[model samples]
Target: MTIKLNLIAAACENMGIGKNNNLPWKLKSEMDYFSRMTSKTIDPTKKNVVIMGRKTWDSIPTKYKPLQNRINFVLSRSNLDLKNCKDVYASNSLESCIEKLEDNAFKSVYETVWVIGGRHIYEAALKSDSFHRLYLTKILKTFDCDTFFPPLPTNLKKVSDPDVPEELQTENGIDYTYNVYENTQFGK
Candidate 1:
């Protein structure tokens, strides 16, 4: 069974993603877009899986976590606890997370697997052959950030996605555009 592994994120002009373990900027539209994309599934009976680094999981608001209606997987070498959160699981590494997703139980229940992240998880996903697409929001303005997303691979080609809006979206006085890039060498 082939599972489409996707990476989703929003970055500033400098490719900065976060500051002090939180989002540097507030854009409700961008956050809404992320919520919709990661939670959407083509099959009504199946749910999408979001794999994130431990830090990313921590960054989410406590009340909204485990992200609702989707399966959440956190990658951490340490003992990251989530015993009370429904639909949340813990994996030691990205490889282990992917392995668990490919298992018969998960394969039958889940549709797409999205890597939503902190720096290290995004970097690891970019280096994996299993990763297929990047759903990125290009924030036009620069922000003060200490953490950044890794540069896109040379083989990834920008592709038009009908699901993404073509026009620039302005929120909280900042302009941004949604983009989708597919790996050119993915299936070859």
Candidate 2:
């Protein structure tokens, strides 16, 4: 069975992801969009995995560290203890992590696995041929950020956007678009 990888993130015009370990904006619409996109119930036959880099995990608020109801896999070189986290695993390389997950038979049961990130992990996913869909929220603003999402791949095509407002522009002087791309297009 093949692994179905998905990405969920927001980025600035410069692809900046975070500033001072926080999101650049607190748009309610963006939060709603994120919740709607990621709240699907996990398929029991398949395992749902959320992969993130070390810094990204640290960036998450202490209250939300152990994101509820899904397996959390962290990619880190350091031997940090992740308390209150369920099914926590760590790896130095994305490939090795994926291999371990596969070896443990994670894909056979889960319909979709997500690569939730904080910049570096997103870059790794973009370069690899592992993902099937990219769920991005382009915030219309630039921030002083140390992390950023990588550019979208040309091969993917937009598939859905039910909530994007017409003529909607971000308060930060950037024009944003909500796009979903599939790895393969069945027809024009």
User: Over the stretch 57-176, how does candidate 1's per-residue lDDT look in tens digits?
Assistant: 989888898898899999999998789888999999998888888888768898888999888999999888887999999999999999999988999899987789989899888999
Return the lDDT, model 1, position 45: 95
Candidate 1 has an lDDT of: 0.90
- The lDDT per prediction is 0.90, 0.71
Off by over 4 Å in 2: 42-47, 161-177, 184-188
List TM-scores for all candidates, in order: 0.97, 0.79
Clash count, one per candidate: 0, 5
Which ten residues in a row are the worst by lDDT in model 2? 164-173
Alpha carbon lDDT at 180, candidate 2:
68
Among all windows of 10 consecutive residues in model 1, the one with the lowest summed lDDT is 1-10
Error of 2 at 103 (Å): 3.1
Model 2, span 87-138: residue lDDT tens: 6777888888778767755555445568889788888877666777787767
